[model samples]
Target: MVVDLVVIGTAITLGPLHNSAFILLLTAERGVRRGLVFILSWLAGLLMVIAAVILLTGGTPPARQSVPSTAALAGKLALGLGLVAYGERKRRRPPRPRHAPKWMERPDRVSGWTAAGLAILLQPWAMVGAGAATAVDANLSSIASTLALTGFCVLATSSMLAMELYTTFSPVAAEAKLRGLRDWLDTHQDQAIVSLSLLLGLWLVADSIYQLVE
Candidate 1:
């Protein structure tokens, strides 16, 4: 039970950060209300993913032995290259002035429930991790343990929320801290995200190749 909770918590933390949808949603909104909504939606998506994975894998957690083949390696590499190229293309594009949405423009009118739902539905990674966890623990029947797992997920995600809150409430201070990092990223944005993509892709490719060879 402890192991399961730890695994679930770690999955939630890592999944949401890298999940494209989660990042996009977080970037699109401003303030704690939006952040809360994103968290709700993220959790919802995660639950759904867990359900699906459980169904597909017959309630079995994906074992390391289930890794893909060499051909899969080539595919992962191609996918990684494609992602890097896309990031480069985006970097080259000029930033358009952001237009505030009607609701966002009227901050007082925003609905927390709606924000939470939308954020969760938009992200895919949350769903994947949740699904995987659900699959792994399909037979586990400890309600208290399950609740503990959920609590850990919420706690893990709080890190992102805390960061957002800090930036929103203390813009001057946040900006000061971020200034150097932002400048560095601006100067090497393409290379940075691309390099990250490549590294992740290579890791995936190598793993797949190893699985196939074994």
Candidate 2:
């Protein structure tokens, strides 16, 4: 239970903090409400993945048990390559034109609930990781473990909500920071994405190789 809580908490924190999906969403959207909405959409997407994983793997061994196999290693390598390729593609793409919608330009027109729900749904990796962790804990048939998993999810979500609120309210700071980032991205988007993708791919390859060796 303790282990499950720690793992899940870490996954949730990392997902919101450094996940490319969240960063891309923030980069694309300028307003606080939109940013929140994007996150909610991401979360909602994640929930769908979670539900699917739970339903499919409910009676199966944990992913850790399955992912260390030769087949899994190959799949991970493929996934790593795919991620690298995706990042490279993003880098090569031209900048999109910005056109503000009438609704988006109005501060009072945004829907908070919708945004929250959507953000929760869209981040599929976070959802799957959290769900898998929760499932493993649940399989232990310990009420304490279950409670801890739930607590971790709630705490992580709360932390994200707080951060989003702070970011949204600080328009001047947020805009300034985003403007600087945008300019940087425009000049070095491909290099940045490719570098990150390569690093992540290397990590994946190393992990897979270690699993095979072990």
Candidate 3:
């Protein structure tokens, strides 16, 4: 479970879309406040998913080979397959011209509420769903299980959190560096998406099959 969550969380944090949007938030007017809001909103969404899973599982791993356990694994299998297919399609398609979304056009003018909403909107939800599915195995009564979930949340949000703090402390340097990072991300966005989707999807699929047959 910990390993699965770590992989999923890394995929989530490495997503180019949200990270690009976050850079915009950091460079906006009153960026510190907006960036904080974005992080809080992003964290809230992750917590909600994990919380719902914990509630359903009641802090216990479902009995292996039971209906609930099978269902959870099956859900992950389906999601994994979906990601694999999506990633393959992207990989085979010709690279198209990329343009910034209209919402990103005026990030400097984005309101606090808009920033929060963007945080929610920009989540790599497919990967987030994978995280939630993997989290179903969390046995919260165990210290390790509890820590794994906490670590997943922290790891998933680490990028945005790092940026917010970096900007707050060193606005001058952070601006140039973050902007450069954003440009690079935009240029390589498709490759990044394809790589993360295929690699993580294959991991989940292989793991799910192993668990099912074991």
Name the best candidate (by lDDT).
Answer: 3
Query: What are the per-model C-alpha RMSD values against the true structure?
Result: 7.4, 6.6, 1.0
Estimated TM-score for each candidate: 0.49, 0.52, 0.97
Worst 10 residues of 3 by lDDT: 98-107
Which sequence of candidate numbers ranks them by lDDT, best first?
A: 3, 2, 1
lDDT of 1 by residue, 121-160 (tens): 4443422333243335343365664565466556546545
Tens digits of per-residue lDDT, candidate 2, 1-214, equal 3553454344454442233333334434455556667656554554454455446546343555464235545665565566567766766777666553354344344466644544554443522343443444244255665465456555445545554665667755755665565466555545655665555555555655675577
Q: Give the TM-score of candidate 3.
A: 0.97
**Candidate topping TM-score:** 3
Off by over 4 Å in 1: 1-33, 61-85, 88-108, 121-158, 164-195
* lDDT on C-alpha atoms for all candidate structures: 0.48, 0.50, 0.91
* Candidate 1 Cα RMSD (Å): 7.4
